[model samples]
Target: MKNKILVLGATGNIGRPLVENLLARGEQVKAASRSGQDVLGAEGVVFDYFKPESFEQAFEDVNRAYIMLAAGYVQAKDLLIPLIEFAASRNIKVVLQTAFGVDADDAIPYRQVELALIQSGTPYVILRPNWFADNFHTFWKAGIDHGQLAIPAGDGKSSFIDVRDIAESAAAALRTEQFDGQAFNLTGPEAFSYAEAAQLLTEVIGKPISYNAIDDDTFIDMLTSAGVPADYAVFLSSIFYPVRQGWTSVITDDVATLTGKPPRSLKTYAQDHRQQLANS
Candidate 1:
C-alpha cells in the first residue's frame, strides 16, 4: 500500500535479517516468500520464481527490490533475468545477491543474470558473497553432527562469510544509490581450508570434528543418499572444483566498505553459533 522495499525469500537466513535491518531504519518493507508467510512488521506476499504472475503484486508500489535466488533452484539466469527485466521496466532499483567468482566466465548462469542487470538500463547493485559460515549448521550440519565434514575441497581454503554481514550489506545497498551499478564481492576477514575449519570447529565446540576429502563422485553419492536430488547433488559437487583450486580463498573489504564494520571472522561465527552448531 506504500512505497516499499520488496524482499524476496523473505523468511530466509539473509532475507529475515535484511528485512529487520530495513525496518530498523524505518523503511517500509514487503516481505515475500513462496508461502506468503508474514515477516516481522513487514507486509507479506506470496512470490515464486516459477510463477510470473506473482511478480506484479510483489513489485507493486515498491521502489526497490532485493533479489536473491531461493535455495535448491539452479536455473539462475532463466528465473532471475525475467524478473529483473520486469523490475527494470517498472524502473525499480535492484540489489542482486549472486555467488562469488561467477564473473570469471560469462557462461555462468549467475554471471549471465548480472550481465542482464547491467545492461537493463536500470539502477542496480550486485552483491557476490563468498561461502557462508552458517553452512556448518545447515548444509553440512549432518556431517558435523557425525563429527566429520566430508567434501571434495581437499586442502584449499575459503573465506567463509556470515549471512548477517551479507544482510547488512544488502540493506546498505538497497538504502542508497551511491553503490548503484557497482558490484561488490563480499567475503570474511580470513580464509581456512576445510581441515583447518574442522580444527577450528573442534576447538570452538570442544568436540572432535574432522574433515574428509572425498572425490566429487563420493560427495555426490553422500548427498543423493541424504535425499538431495541427484542433479542438485552433482551440481553442488561441481562448484567445489573452485574450492579445491584455491579460488575461494580471496578476502575483500567490501563488507566493511558497505556496512562500515569489519566482517565477522569464522571463529566468531563458530563461537557465537556453538549451540546451533552442536544441536541445530
Candidate 2:
C-alpha cells in the first residue's frame, strides 16, 4: 500500500492506460472495474457507483484516486457525488474525468459533481476532455463497416482527443499536488468536422466512408435501431447540439502541458488505430 493510487473505471479506455502510466512511474496502483478482474501489471478491485459498499474496498490503502463515470448512464450527479464524498472523507486526492463543456453551465450534472469536489476542500484536479477519437472504432465502427457515418453533427468540427492523452493527463494530475485545485481542458492538436474526419478514415483504412449529416430524430432512431438504449441514444444526440453550434472545435495545449508532449492529431489517431477502424 505504498502511496497507492486507485483508478476507478480501470478497464476502460483511459483508465487502463492511466494505470500503466502510473505503474511505469513506479506508483503502487489499484485498478478498479465492475468485475474486479486483475489487470496485467496492477491489482484489481470491484467498484460500482451504485454500490456504496464497494467504495471502501476500492479506496482501501490508496492515497489517490481517479474518478470517472462509465459511458451510458446519464445521472452523473447522483452516481458521482457519493464517491467524491467518500474519497474526500478519506482525504484521498482526486483527479476527476468529466466531459468537455460541462463547466460551461453549473446546472450540468458533471459540473455539479465538480463543484461538490471543489467545495469539499479536498485536493483535486479536473480534466475535461473533448470528444474521443477512439469513437471511430467503438461507436461508429458499424457505420464505417457500412461505408457511412450518420450523425446529427452538421458541418462542425471537434478537436477530438486521443484517449491516451487523457490518461497521461490524469496520471500527471495524480502524481503531484502542484496542479491541485486546478482544472484543465484537454483537447487534440486540431479540429476536424465529421466529413473531414471520414475522409481521413477513408484514406487510413483504405475504404470509402462517407458522412451523413442527419437530423437529431434520425440520429436517435439510428442509434436505437443499433440496439443502443433509447434514453441514452437521446442523450448522445443532444450532445451533438454543441458540435453543430461550433463549441467543440476548440484546441488546447493542456495535453502537452500535462504530459510534456503534444496531443496526437486526428490523422495520427486514424493512422495508429487503422487496424481497428479497418475491421468490420
Candidate 3:
C-alpha cells in the first residue's frame, strides 16, 4: 500500500522540496501549513502549531507525518506532545526534523519536543540536521549581496547541509519504516568556515566577498537593523557562540547513508546559486 504522508510546514525550505519528492514517488500527500496552503497539487490542510484544534483534521487518515517546528515559537513542546500522542493512538509514524545537539535532557525547546515524541511511544525517526547551506541565500543573502558576510561565528567551521538534502532524507525516512526509533545527525560532506564559504562564493559569483566576524551584540544589531525580529536575532546569534566554541565543525556521512548519495558540498551550493550571489 502506498503511504499517505502529511507534511507540516510544507511550504518551507525543506518541506517544499520534500513535498515534490513524495509526489513524484506517487505517495499521497496532505500538505499542511498555517494558512492551508498547497504546494503543487498536493492536498492542503490548515495547521497551526500553537492551535491544537487544527491538528486533528490535519492528521486524519494519515499514515505518517513529516514534522518541523517553526522557529521563534514558544509552544513547541505543548504542540508536539499532543500531536505525537494522537499520532501514536492512530498508529501513525512520525519523522521529526530536529536540530543537532538536541538530546532528551537538553534545555533547548527542540530537545524538549524530542523527549515528548519519544515518551509518546510513537514510531519515530529523528533527523538532527546541522545548519542549512541555504541560509546563504535566505538568512545571509543581504550580507552576501553586499559583499560582506557578517556573523558572530568567529573562526568557526560548520558542516552546513543543503536544505534539499535534508528534505530528501526526510522523504526517505517517511517512506520506509526501516529507520524507526533512530536518530541521524545529518551534515554536508565537508566543513567550511564563514571565510572559506565567502571565498567559494567569490570564486563562483565572480565577486570579492569577505567574511566579517563580529561580536554577538554587533551581529544581533545587524540582523535587527535588517528588520529581523529582535528576539529571533538574539536567538540566532546565541547559537553561533557554540559554533565559535567549535560545536558544529564535525562532518558526517549520514546524509549519504540515508539518501544513497553524498551530501552536496558547499562549493556545489555556491555554484548552483551563482546567479543569486552574482546579482547580490
Candidate 4:
C-alpha cells in the first residue's frame, strides 16, 4: 500500500517542495494549510492552528504527518500539544521541523513543543535545520536590492541549509522507519558570514551588494518600519544575537546522511538563483 502522509504548512517554503517530492516518489499526500489552497495536485485540506476542532478531520487516515508551526500564530504549546494528542490517539507518526540549538530543556518555545512531542509517546523525527539560504532571496531580497544586506548579525557565520534539502530529508524520513524517534540537526556543507554571503551574491548578481551589521534595536526598527509585526520582528532580530556570538557556525553531515547526497552549497544556491540576484 502507498503511504498516506499529511503535510502541514503545505504551501510554505519547505512544505511546498516536500509535497512535490513526496508526490514524485508516488506517495499519497494530503496537503494542509491555513488557506487549504490546492498544492501541486495533492488533496487540499483546510487547517488553521487557531482552530483545534479542524485538526481531527485533517488527521483522518493519515499514517504520518509533517508538522510545522506557522509563524505569527498562537502559542506553539497551545496549538501543538492538542494536535499531537490527536495524532497520538490516531496512531499517526509525526515528523517535526524544528530549529537548531533546541534541546529538551531549552527555553525556546519550539524546543518546548519538541519536548511535548517526544513525551507524547508517539513515534516522531525532529529535524533541526540551520538558517536557510533562501532567506537572502525571500527575507533579505529588499536589502540586497537596496545594495546592502543589513542585519543584526555582527560577524556571525551560519551553516545555512537549503529548504529543498530539508524537505527532501523530511520526505526520506516519512517514507521509511530508519529515522524514527531521531533528532537530526541539518546544515549546509559550509558556513559563511553575512558579509561573505553578501560578497557571493554580489559576484553572482554582478552588483555591489554589501552586508551592514546593525544593533538589535536598529534591526527591529527597520523590520517594524517595513510593516512587520512588533513581536515577530523582535523575535527575528533576537535570533541574530546568538549568531553574532558565533553560535551557529558549525557544518554537519546530517543532510547527506538522510538524503544520500551532500547538502547544496551557498555558491550553488547563489548560482541557481542568479537571475533573482541579477534582478535585485
What does candidate 4's lDDT look like per residue over 143-176, in tens digits? Answer: 9889998898999899999899999999998998
Estimate, for each residue in 1-280, the C-alpha lDDT of model 3 and write its tens digit. Answer: 5357999889888989999999999999999998897788999999987788897899887989998877665456777777778788887898998887667347888888788788778899999999899899888888887899988899989998998899999988998888899889999988889999899888888888899999999988887888888888887887887689777888888888788999998888888887876774
**Model 1: per-residue Cα lDDT over 197-237, one tens digit each:** 99999999999999999999999989998899988898899
Candidate 3 global lDDT: 0.86
lDDT for each candidate structure? 0.94, 0.92, 0.86, 0.88
Can you list the residue pairs that collide in candidate 4?
Answer: none
What count of clashes does model 2 give?
Answer: 0
Off by over 4 Å in 3: 72-75
The parts of candidate 4 lying over 4 Å away from their true place are: none
Which of candidates 1 and 2 reaches a greater lDDT?
Answer: 1
Which one wins on lDDT?
Answer: 1
User: Residue 121 CA error for candidate 3 (Å)?
Assistant: 0.7
Instruction: Flag clash pairs in model 1.
Output: none
Model 2: per-residue lDDT, tens digit, 51-159? 9998888998988999999998989989999998998988889999999999999988899999999998879999999999999999888999999999999999999
